[model samples]
Target: MSAGRHGRHEPVYRALELIANGLVRAQRLDLHVTGLENIPDTGGAVLCVNHTGYVDFLPLALGVQRAGRRTRFLIKSEVMDIGIMRFLVNHTRTVPVDRSRGAEAYRAALGRLREGYIVAVYPEATISRSFELKEFKSGAVRMAAEAGVPIIPAIVWGAHRQWTKGGARNMGRSRLPVHVRYGLPFTPGPDESPERETLRLRETMNSMLLEVQDSYGPHPPGEFWVPSRLGGAAPTPQEAAVIEADEALRKAEARAKRAADRARSRGSRR
Candidate 1:
């Protein structure tokens, strides 16, 4: 995989991305990635992806990983307080902001990007019900403008299908083909407010999404797509090794802890 814009050559991003990517692969789900050639080879960048359902985040995450950039995401505050999710997200360096606290969240998002992390901000801000794109928000625009980083518009369609409005309860079906589209990097003029700038960026991103849809044509009742040829390099050794080691270590640690608990139980019986 190519190094991200920051020139840090991160394996952590690669590892985390690899683990999540299995979700895409094991299902035999194919990704149609377009404009990937447009992703900058090097510094901090903003990725604004379409939000649909819960699965939407994972597909987008995996897609970003495929692009070779580890993105720090702006996550909901409530999600941060959950048991293991907090640990996982924090470990990945995701920044969580309380939806209730608007100003603070905005500042924090920009601050993290300024700190040189490629942050993913959802311009839709919240989930949408519309089939087409909805009104765009400016959180992303403002952050990029303030941080002075280029912004990349991304759209992930078809994710809403597996768990459609009222579909099957189980996540069945393998190789659920998904589309991940990206647009060339662009920045808003410094004169605008974050909100205004965010909308401009969102509009451009929406265009990219629309373009992809046009190229692939309207998806079936539940689908989205990319025009990319279903081909790319094989998963690198570093990616595979990290994934194996992390899973093994997690299992070993869990087993050790379980053994300790059993010993405690036996001693307590005494």
Candidate 2:
């Protein structure tokens, strides 16, 4: 069965909460949450989160559940394509974002917000390989502005150790430390530009992340999944920037070489 056309995911969402609760217990994951009361209990709002790892979603969902509200995440369309997972995701009222047609997802999110439901958006758009906060996209702020709802910034630290884009796997760690903190909800300033609003959101998120990291104690030694700032093997933000720049240079060189090779071949043929 699917969620009602009106977008109610209740009973099923409640069930999802139960399952999430069980998963936390079974996995022996340690979750630390703060500022959850900032989530508006009776109105539409946007939860803007940082993208760290694949496993991060569960904790974020649990945080929202604990806040006494049901939330629909803006998930990748590819996840909804999974045959078995599609049914569950659909009934949970998650919004599917086709990268090519991102506007549709924005509209769906706005619609949900208008219906007085909570919507979660990852402003980074994708997981950061460096396990650090990435540049923010304007989507979250745009949605909140257009929907006339407040935006709550949520930062989750430590999930990157479980599974990250860098391919580090530390899921076997018992009682893995994870912290989720929600910042106070704030609405966009009147006539605020998307870039300005996004910048504000990014600052709030990064600050929250740093606070969580500070209180969580030192990270696991020699773990590639840990952020470099915490003494792990993950690259620092500066290192990641250099790596990205080097990659762009390498790709440019390869394209130039290919073009030259093609030119030489055409000349020879002539």
Candidate 3:
């Protein structure tokens, strides 16, 4: 693995990295990481990653840390609202993205990249229940272009087996094998359209993802963590999309109900 110059260290970040890595080791996750040399040792870059499960970031960050760099992942602001999470996110200098005010998060990420930090982004925005690449958002490519940095595409496979949406958590000593692959970094051309570039990025990551899945071993038939196309019983992309839409609508209605209840309570007191 090629090493890059270490960026400025945050005591808290380093401590957390050690703890997380310790947990990973204890779990004995059979991690196979490749292409660490692709990560530049010293400058800014946007690390675009494919999201498969909730713990996907852990393995991806592990690989980045191996390259002598820490990742500032673009996490949703709601996660920052949690008590312990808030402290962790703040001290680790994670970029909190309020989806309702995404522009602010985008600008913050751009600033970090310009400051020579590796800003990691999940272009899919959410975990794919189908275990397949979802539609890509242009934000990652746009940020790289605007910040004048390279885009490094990365993929983590087999994380979903440990914990994922709609899947049972296996905190046991399953010793699952996780595969991480980082493709060579590339800079977007000044005149390239963001949409076109975003599509290319998605395609590249998708190809890498499939390659990792294929080489990871035979995906068992009817297994919950494997994609349906590969013989597992996981939802297809279309089925997962519908499930996600329903989940979103349900959450929106719940939020609206809570707002109305709060307003009623306030009026009664007045």
Candidate models: Cα lDDT each: 0.66, 0.81, 0.89
Give the distance in Å from residue 186's predicted Cα in candidate 3 to where it truly belongs: 1.0
Best by lDDT: 3
Per-residue CA lDDT of model 2 for 1-270, tens digit only, reads: 221122234677677778878878877888998998798867788888888789888898788877667778887788876886798777777898887798787888888888887888888876776778889889788878888899999988877767776665766636888899999999998687999989998998888888888898777776786788777887888888777677779979998999999999999999
Whole-model lDDT for model 3 versus the true structure?
A: 0.89
> Which residue pairs does candidate 2 place in steric collision?
none
Candidate 1 colliding pairs: 5-42, 5-43, 6-43, 27-175, 28-175, 29-175, 29-176, 138-198
The estimated TM-scores of all candidates read 0.71, 0.83, 0.95
Per-residue CA lDDT of model 3 for 1-270, tens digit only, reads 112355445778878888889989888999999999999988899999988888889999999989888888898899876899999888876899998899999999998888888989999999999989999999999999999999999989988899999999986678999999999899988899999999999989988987888789979898999899988889999999999999999999999999999999999999
* lDDT, candidate 1, 191-214, per-residue tens: 767777766776776677677666
Cand. 1 TM to true fold: 0.71
**lDDT: the better of candidates 1 and 2:** 2
Question: Highest TM-score among the candidates is held by which one?
Answer: 3
- Report the alpha-carbon TM-score of model 3 versus the true structure: 0.95
Sorted by lDDT, highest first, which candidate order results? Answer: 3, 2, 1
lDDT of 1 at 6: 32
